[model samples]
Target chain A: MDEEAAKKLIVETLQKKKGKSKFYLKDFYKMLPDEKPRTVKNLVNKMVGEETLEYWSSGSTTLIGLKGVGKQAGAEDEED
Target chain B: MVEFRHKTPLIDQLETGPWTSFVSDIKREHESRMENPKGIDFQFNQDCCDDLLGVLELSYEHGRTHWKHGGIVGVFGYGGGVIGRYCDQPEMFPGVAHFHTMRVNQPMGHFYSTKYLEQIMDLWERRGSGLTNMHGATGDIIFLGTSTPQLEEVFYELTHNIKQDLGGSGSNLRTPSDCMGQSMCEFACYDTQEICYQLTMEYQDELHRPAFPYKFKFKFDGCPNCCVASIARSDISFIGTWRDDIRIDQEAVKAYVGGELKPNAGAHAGRDWGPFDIQKEVIGLCPTQCMSWDGSKLEINTPECTRCMHCINVMPRALRIGLDTGCSLLLGAKSPILDGAQMATLVVPFIKVEPPYDEIKETVIEPIWDWWMEEGKNRERLGELIKRQGMQKVLEVTGFKAIPQMIQEPRSNPYVFWKEDEVPGGFKRDINEFRKYHQR
Candidate 1:
């Protein structure tokens, strides 16, 4: 799929999900045909930097969400 | 051929026996093992035994041979590794064994009970070295080494039916309080044990999970005596404080002055002479020289008083503390990590919250994780991170309002000032003068 088409599919999938925090580049890539994992990771990092999305977890199963999705996770919350 | 260094007479004098020989052998082996042989030196430390066990366990686990010596030895691995130290006198420690170490539970402090302690002791006595340090530094109990197969069984039994947990090790919440509180102490203002147990129960998952870049410690003291030294050590320290007037007894003071009562010895001995005599004594002890006495009235120069509370505790009956009080939340205090020694600072003025209050948990824990998760680098302690980043950032992220008690960088600021004219001196007769007046 083309870049524009992939972006559209990603946005649609994010909107459909009950938890926006669950959306990730991999999810977007999985929905699109012929998308590289690296591309997905880069796009996600870019979004996080732009404050459009939040990224947590250093591992492959990273938790992503809108900048302010649920109540602010406290200092204690970050323990998990 | 390896050249064997004969054991010294000092080594023989020390009844550690083969352990010292083992260390010598390791040193000799290492000399040959490495192309460049470094001289073997023996240094002793009380805490080294546990570290030595950890090293030995990791070495054996990795299929590496460890040379026994009189001292502790261990290697560092990326995530987890063993440390081992040898003690000279095993008979002094009958229930322990050689080649023992602890398994690091990444974030939280987890451990089994006294029974587990006994079992581990039994295993150590049986298969490995006859010595162990139960839940010492890393908050995990040190199991003296056993056969590789015994390790699995031991780990399983210890982990099974675990009661108390291994507290935080790497960048996570540490084990909660393990101290007596108001239930035992006359000075305790809150139920510290309850709070500690509550937190432990409520946040078990958080305690065990290793998500943060560094580890965190929470410690609670029932009162200012701070048996745990929570203020200086823990990332989140909860100390009990009263906001009420101190209870003073004039009769008790008079009796104390008559040498009827004496304070306990050691650091606090000189200051004891309660209910009222202690306050009278404070006239001389006040650092700011704010306390004064007339023939009939005792006055406190509030502005000059540093609120150290020495007078109040010294004469509990003669002087009562105020009831309209709250705890002063301090921050940024920690042990030396990236920097030198640091002190826990008064960050929040008296927070007017009820005791047994979960607000402490809500307020302190939330902000701690937020900042640590965002700003902390691996192995950097919470206090170090806060110091590097600044308290403003912590306040912003934690959403805690700043107060006068939150005196940032107190050492840099001048002491609280009082005008010289305000102090009343020499108005009242001294104890000797009073005697003379009575005689007259």
Candidate 2:
């Protein structure tokens, strides 16, 4: 899929899940089933780099969400 | 270089114990660093050891800790392997104000050459606090304290000079570790170290990146003895076993019985537990009642043997693991966190563990990761998720058949969750039909 189309679909999916601001990368993989898993991952990572999406981590796990959405990363992150 | 700044009366009290104190270690490091220093960039102009002592003193004084968790701090292109930390009393302890931890992945079996060890120590001395935990709970060489800005520089030198990579820290595959199997142990059923290295190399991206919904861990054990405690501490535990009969040396067994050979490799030499009695100890202790002695020879009912390794542990000279060896793949084990602690549930009972363990990856690992990334909660461990979703779902997802070995015992409650499709008539059965039959 083209970058624009992938971004559009990803944004649309995140926007549609009104109650849930955060989602696993696989959630997007499910939304774009026709694309290869690796391809979807690359697109998502690209979006993250572009500030279209952000990562929210619990220190044990990380979830992807639309920029400035859902839980914020803070002092509660997992310690060594 | 900095001088001793804090007068720690409370910290001093701990040094009076029988065991060596960490306070002493820190004081020694403080003195040593003050005398001869290895420079780090962005110098706080305050000694880390001194500040560490100060923090401890403050913690003891306040009756609580003065450190707070800091936000994400990592090397370029990686989401894990570094944990950020900060002191609440930064003004009083500037050196540890931005202290962070870096977990360097250890070599297989944690076997390090003297040259490699020195290089790591030298590098750490230059770039961070010389103090280190030989290993952390997750089996990584933990570089305990460093400033945030120096992270990338330390990582670069570590990878370039020492030829070492960083271990996992955040919600990713924590460092894959195993006991020293074939390398140092005779009881090893399979090469645990080889598999650990292979898996670690294979899943480098997963190890260094934050991909999972929660933390995932993989631990390998050469035998069911589980020296590394994989069964209790990992998300996926690969434990070696065999389906064939336990190899027995009748002569050795006789030697043990005749008091010519020692039991438990003579490990209990300090205590006098009376003469070894095979009948009272070995045979009597077999969980399955599968062993017997017939005056001249010892016999084992191999078919009924559960491979619990009790008899083998007791009579190591006589008993050996079966020749046809493989490992059992168990899933979803972790410490007490969101869910209570759980030992890994048996999933695949036996698999021939070979190099580039593609069978394990395809059959178990990938499928579970795929499912977990989709269904697992934000901080839910795989074990907790498995418990919440039920083992039946795991069986279906992994394409494994349900076997009796998967569970400890059949459910005693008889509260079967009969699904609609499984029953002859669907769950939509009419109350009117029941009323017609009973005339209620």
Candidate 3:
């Protein structure tokens, strides 16, 4: 899938899974099946850097949520 | 041949005990092997084990790997073909520690004379690991356990002695290998050895550079026999082929039919078993159903023959491969690592493989290097990159339009895909047309 489409899919999925507990980085990567792990990691990092997505860490695991969408998701799930 | 080792920190540790069981086991096995009629000489690589220990000491940190990890490294001058390895754990059993490997490119068909073999073996024994892998997956002679200094010396001497340098490393070509082509095989259509040599010589710099995103291998097979296993191993594969007819020797065929097939299996073997039923066997077993037996004689519809090695292997004396031979180029086959394992896809259905092989190199090889260098990701093999960035882009950039024969295997996965934006030109109204369009 194209980059724009992939990002769109990620946002939509995050919105859908809002308050459904957590959306871990690995789970988000799984959603982008065509993407390489490196590519997915880069995409995630870019999104988090730009605040396009909110990253918070639940213990050691990292989670990504859409920018404006609010969810307890989990504490310390990649959120600095 | 020579002993050129100095005891380091790791060596001292291994010899100071705790490896009593392992050492005794090795001695026991060696003793048993010595009992065999053809005796065995096992070189207990004490230095290699020590090196292993040293690596473990360096790499192991608390519960994980240390800072110095995988990257491009060698003795010096040489760019690739040497793989540096580290021990998984120093805290466990320290004896079996430093585990680095070096890859040596072999000549076509691996035909090494005793003298040359002895020379290279001497280098390995004195400078690095006495142990060697005859042919690894990349077709290079993997020399296990060598320090940075030792590796440099080996490379220097090897190039000076044989004039043949190390195979590719770090994103470049991984040695082009071929079977015993015209050298000793009657089945060989094109000169497999010649092409292998030509490619190695022409692209020496490329072979020694870390230019591409990852490793690219080129393996050649003399015929569909695929002795070199190009079909499933290489990024670029060349298989010798023909577009003509199979030659039949009726006299040889009749001799086999009249029970003279295996004249020397034993003194009375041929007379007792009688003749093979050619009609029931050879004719019936022709995969494409293209052969006919007219009671006494055998006739083969050559065009329908898939060159599957069945007929030639069965009746070696009677059937001869055609003269009008060339090669077919296949792309993107490799062992799984980042992406899943893949079989090569046919790129060029057929091309003339005459001297210099300009057409094949220019039309097929160069374009691929150019394209992959520009787009492929680091550590992404050619096959994986092609899958990631659509085969359609490869077709467009390489200018190799797809053909029916180019389907290396029936599509079993969704990895091979075409982009909606890049459509093929020329469409007519028919089912065959649809098939043709999809084939591209």
Candidate 4:
């Protein structure tokens, strides 16, 4: 159950947030309410290693985005 | 005098123009309403409005009535009454962003016990601006100033002692309001006070929480005269009306013509609504062109007569609203934000509005919102959601699947986008197809 929930949240969050801009591991880590930073870090590492999520490094920060999930992701009605 | 922690120089600069006259007039109006202007405090509230003035000036830069941000503030498990505002020019005007407002839901018809009103006034004087917007566009008593920390405690005590709660805000059901119904108006067909009170109480939790995609408002008026103007303003509007034909008293009509009717017999009388004055005033002015008069009698064509209150208002002795009183429901009205401003659509032409109003909740109110909450976007209201996914789909989801109003001439109106699945099994294509079938 935890694994399924964690996977769903990661996919939905990546889909909702826009742009190629980098998201810091610490600030991004804070958004998960129930799961710990360690659990999320391990999940993120596993997913990145498996090529299910896009991950890279810019300076000391880590960034992640969707892996061809455009069809599944709904576009948010954001103001310009 | 209360010292200021926040001040905007731009507000002082702008006060010299049209604002000066506006402020002076409002101040005079405020003083007139106050019993003891100096007893508790009036100066603090004035300063609060002055602070908000700076924030409002910044809001107008984008477009009128559009806010660039949301910083809504309130007490625990409650997000209704208080509104927080911020000035856009942070560098130019520092510490000017924390301008806050408190809104008290207006009593139905603005009726209040003198003791209750005094209790509220004293409370406001002590904690908030003695000044207020008598009623705002949302039909709430808007108290103009207070900081964040002071609001929670003030609301807790005030709501408790006053036996009232704060009104709704954010993406929940906002405060529902109504004009004086049976309490004052002779034309009232349904109980405005009861409906307003019941809905407010039933949805109290919804009113406090920001759970919906956007805000919802409900307002009521007794008749088509629309004293509250609910048709253009509220998201859900219940207008008092009748399904049966209007009642007319012919003997009384003759009495009015013969100069034998009394002036206080409800409404019309003589030259000052006198006996001889009604034929032209009442019969001549009916918009539906359904009334006629001879020397001895008055005739009302029931089928042609629209249930407008003109004749009834002019000669209450001669005409009455029908016995089968009910209400009409309209949906989707709001000021423009993400979309253009919209007038409410006549969703339910007539529904019997008896006590409990369970039918209204079951058929119209709950279903429409259930669909909206599931499908609605961040700023999209029910009306706009209809535009995105078709009205056919909205009606289907809301359980009004086969309304006669939706089945009528579809080509005539652009908003009536019918689904192909809704077509009857043995349907004919058009008039030509119908004619061919008849010829057989």
Error of 3 at B16 (Å): 28
Reference A-B contact fraction recovered by candidate 3: 0.00
Candidate 2 vs candidate 3: which has greater TM-score? 2
Model 2 RMSD in angstroms? 4.5
lDDT tens digits by residue: candidate 4, B116-230:
8788877776666555677888788877555556677568767788876777666567889998998988789888988898988887766754445567889898887788888
| Candidate 1 Cα misplacement greater than 4 A, ranges | A1-80, B1-100, B103-120, B123-130, B134-152, B159-162, B265-281, B288-309, B312-326, B352-357, B408-440
Q: Please write out the lDDT profile of model 2 over residues B398-433, one tens digit for every residue.
A: 988877777677885322255689789788878988
Native contact fraction (fnat) of model 2: 0.26
lDDT, candidate 1, B1-440, per-residue tens: 53322323332333466445544433343343322233222111222333343344445455664433311111111111233323233433222234334343322223246775665544444434334444455344544443323434444444564332333333335566544765655666666666677776776645543345555666766656667777887777776666544555666655545556553312355554344354446678887887765534556766565556677666555665455544556665666656787777665555644545677766777667656755566556678877777766667676765555555456574333333554676344487868876875
- TM-score ranking, high to low: 2, 4, 3, 1
DockQ of 4: 0.04
Report, for candidate 3, the interface RMSD.
Answer: 15.3
Which residue pairs of candidate 2 clash? A60-B171, A60-B215
Query: What's the lDDT for residue B376 in model 4?
Result: 71
lDDT of 2 by residue, A1-80 (tens): 67798799889888888788777666777888887655676677678777788655434555678876654433332243
lDDT of each: 0.50, 0.82, 0.65, 0.65
Using DockQ, give the best candidate's number. Answer: 2
Task: State residue B163's C-alpha deviation in candidate 2, in Å.
Answer: 1.0
User: Which tens-of-lDDT digit does each residue in A1-80 have in candidate 4?
Assistant: 38767777776776677764334333335557566544564565456446565432211112444544432111111232
TM-score for each model: 0.56, 0.87, 0.66, 0.70
